[model samples]
Target: MDPPTRSWSIYNRTEITQRYEILERIGSGAYSDVYRARRLSDDLIIALKEIHDYQSAFREIEALEILQKSPNIIVLHEYFWREEEDAVLVLEFLKTDLASVIREAKRNWENGISVGEIKWWMIQILHGLDACHRNSIVHRDLKPANLLISSDVVLKLADFGQSRILLEPGFVTGDEHTHPHEQNTPSQTWMLQQPETIPESDNSNQEQITMSKEEYFKELDDLKAKDSVDETDKETNFNDGDTSCLATYTTSDMEDNPFKSSYSYEAESEGDRSGALTSCVGTRWFRAPELLYGSMDYGQDIDLWSLGCIFAELLSLKPLFPGTSDIDQISRIISTLGNLTEEAWPGCSKLPDYGKISFGKIENPLGLEAYLPNRSSDEIHLVRRLVCYDPASRATAMELLHDKYLNVNPLPVPVNELRVPSTNNGQDESSPGQWRDYKDMDSDSDFEEFGTVDASTTGTGFSIHL
Candidate 1:
């Protein structure tokens, strides 16, 4: 069969080299490399992400295109794609991520992260996730490293390579394999613009501390309403000429990389692509119980479990469950939350590998309080809302936004007040290690290899594909 054909050549390496000056390599993984670059026309810095895997590139482009309008989500200025060439995405540059902030707090702060700062970070994260969830997009990989912080102190959700779109019930498509950018026009340029600053709260309202919880919630409601109106006005005032679908070029070739040898650009039928949706995808430490049981069907709730783990880390300055392997991860979870049973999750026993894996019963569990000894009851309750065994019981991002803890006194601080850590030219050097991508396997037999390999040997986090 002839290989699938691209509709048009968006942009090539020559155009990219002429338009942007490549600064330095900021991050790299098995499937992609991110570089800090400056757009020549306006001297604005941006991130150029070159993805080697076709599937990953397509997924990230589709997800970012749908979410580019959201202030809390990373902006995708444009992308370049061509047959037999790696897809390069032009994205907003962020100096650091939440992982860096947590690390700095642990090292520099004697008392740890302030309550107001924690609330601010949590709010921004929820806003980003709410945008994704509202669009029916599930960010299967939601971790600190993926939540990037800009120089303006604004937090945006980055790294949508592992994202998936869930069709509404009864919805169907005529061409399931169609590429998202196939119908777009040939390359055009997007004018560079300075990053907008997040509005700061007025200090004149210091007396807000004396207000009741009900009044405080009302004040926040009004603030959000005003912000929504302001966003609408900005959208209305935007110039059409400033935004266009454009592409950048890169000269690097991946043909010699051993990891690039297995990738295929062939288009698969809808039936063949069905398995891709259910594949095991996520960092092991923050993965949900259903995923660990080899369940083929899961949803956005899996991200909530990861959020819980991240929030716990923020509070304590360490991972909530730092399991060395998949088995260890499960054991740690059970030891904290008790044995998995029908009582906690009615349909859990029906999971694909439920019968294959077993653990000794734990009459009593350690609970979240034991690990979070210094946190308040309210803070502990917030984590419990998301870390539960049942996916259905997990709190939605919108619901969490209105939680009493965020609305009460000592509310989230302004964006400028956030203590953002310095980074080496937009690169996060404090990351524990790079994320290793495993080759995709269609058989259930490969599940045994999950997290079995020592992370130290690979110098990467425990990640697998099944």
Candidate 2:
């Protein structure tokens, strides 16, 4: 038996000191230290990440290579295995992260981020996810901190250390994993560059303010139809892992209509993709139900789930599902999203951990309006679709941009108007913290370093390994 080979060549610490100068330490985690450094060759300011010698250190290199040309993803320049203790990755440096700007606004003397500004950030985040998924990559960890913002307020996807590139049989790491598509398409460019106009709401007061119960269900059915994965969308072949084999999800797998129960596949078809590279990878609060159910063969829908959770958090300044433990998390999700009945999740009983424990069948309202009282109809509708329980049905990033929720009255605030930490001179700081932010977020940070930890905690950590 042999140990898995890691990426990068050993860089002699003393000889290469002149090439890059470390300016200051920006952040330090249990596994690595992030530094702001200047590349002397051209005086390029790059973020140099030095991680302790471990298989996890090179995850970023693999992810970046696959996503190298994506405008929304952070660019990877140079990488080297430094000594035996670390591997260094040279990456594009951004001014700040969305988490910092969103969470620390009050400390910086700014009002809460306007819904419009949140909308803009949401668009960028989705674009980044689209880039990752287009190449069959899944960013298991998508918390606000991992979403970096440029000086001009452009959001760049960062920290691919926990990312997984979907494979043919199973997942492979390091150089063994060849990328599906390394190039971005002209269509993707056109989609990204499209003028982001916040359209006028087509729904009038009569339409927006009131809807017959029959009309409401009718609209939901219509929305579900719009979200369906049509024949045109399954063009990307997943064999080389370039989006072709989207058959990873069957016709039923992607049947995301809430009116219909969307589970119980008759065994995975040849097109079924089990993305079970690892469970328990995302920040707990934003984790999706499939991950909680221990779905090994999962897909890009998980990222969409987290994106929706982040969207809800931005609006309310509170986590939508702040579950402290796996059981508690499941409970919290059901309490709000309603019971995860076998009817809704067809294969709910088939999951590995499905019968391990039992959860009470507590029923609740399915109306997003009830949860997001002050939010617009479009926002609620979008959230409900994005956070849908059926992975087959979760809204893809591309579908989100055209969602009506974003085009409603009092549209998203523009990028220039976004408040910079040092520049929020006269604004009131109190409003930012007014949202139902958790008083105990410090406690949740305890799980930050447990990204790939073994699922030995039984229920403490929802990490499921087969």
Candidate 3:
């Protein structure tokens, strides 16, 4: 457990105060670098991630802290800002990830992954999502690369940079996680260089009216002033007009309660905590429609959408919607599910990102069924329902687990049975109880400290353990 030595300075602006005995570079990324460090305290190996962007690192730390109690989440043991060095994250490591498996499957066969493996993988992902939802955390970024598989096939959700712990708004602390591929790719380039662009509407009628920059600013200022006045009036007349507020403007107005006064202070505080919770989660592709459409408030159902996508990827061996851009992704969804109708667009005009696409000219309207030709009819139905563009209509994580599609298929093996045994491979055994076993190498103590346990070690030659 000595710190790594500096053969060469890492140029990402992260100063190395004390040399960590420079083990091989485990992984690198656009914004940060990861190294396996041996803690001097107990010689306990831990994953050390050096992050350059202060805001994003903070977001990630917050997420890990919020869910540290959950076994399914990668543990963030310690974090500290070093005045002379880069911000550091100390984490528990796992063996493999779902992304590596999919890549391997694709590498072996151009046709991609088998249907059976995909089903097996999805069930595990659902289990992980269920855990996150119960804890009231949203993994805003859910993709193959972020999911780490242990040697035991115990999948631990990693990378919380974009995740948020759905607590009260004002109390929020900035902490976010970054994608692994983004970190490991070449320095000069990135997988996602820019936020995906929202495409212009092909339909002229739906285009936003062209406003000069000055006019746009003027209109924004006017709206801000109007909103301020409206808030002031509402505050002044709260007692008299609480019930008269418009439905669109209404939030749970349960600040006053007689029952709370009857309880002890601790009980009352607990009740208050239960009453105040609301948030959204999932990546753009996996984002529930309600969040993207700008619903004022949302909840964990957004994460369910991501579960559906994970289910699909584990089954299909590719991203369900590999959208080139936001516009393209939306079109792919609309093309699969048919377009939004007037019934679906109650106040679409007010949405900032809403614009027209050729829903009217759709070549096929059967939606998900058209794309999932290989799937059983029931499975296709489940995906469609879970990934519904409307957040309200999307299925909850618990509901999805109980869906007939999951239950009807050859059900998953008990997590223990399917899990790669530690004895089966020696790599994970080095850490004993600390790491999960994937069918990978026999000796991996070197990488254990960095939160990466190579599950592809079973001499299986690059397998997806999850």
Span of 10 residues, lowest total lDDT, candidate 3: 257-266
For candidate 3, report its TM-score. Answer: 0.57
> Model 1, range 171-287, lDDT digits (tens) per residue?
223233222211121112322211222112432311113343345334434433332123323222211110111111121212111111121222221113333354356666677
Model 1 lDDT at residue 405: 91
Candidate 3 per-residue lDDT, tens place, 247-273, comes to: 111121112210000101111211132
TM-score of each: 0.70, 0.65, 0.57
Ranking by TM-score: 1, 2, 3
lDDT of 1: 0.63
lDDT, model 3:
0.46
The 10-residue segment with the lowest total lDDT in model 2: 238-247
Candidates ranked, most accurate by lDDT first: 1, 2, 3
Candidate 1: RMSD to truth = 15.4
**Candidate closer to the true structure by lDDT (higher is better), 1 or 2:** 1
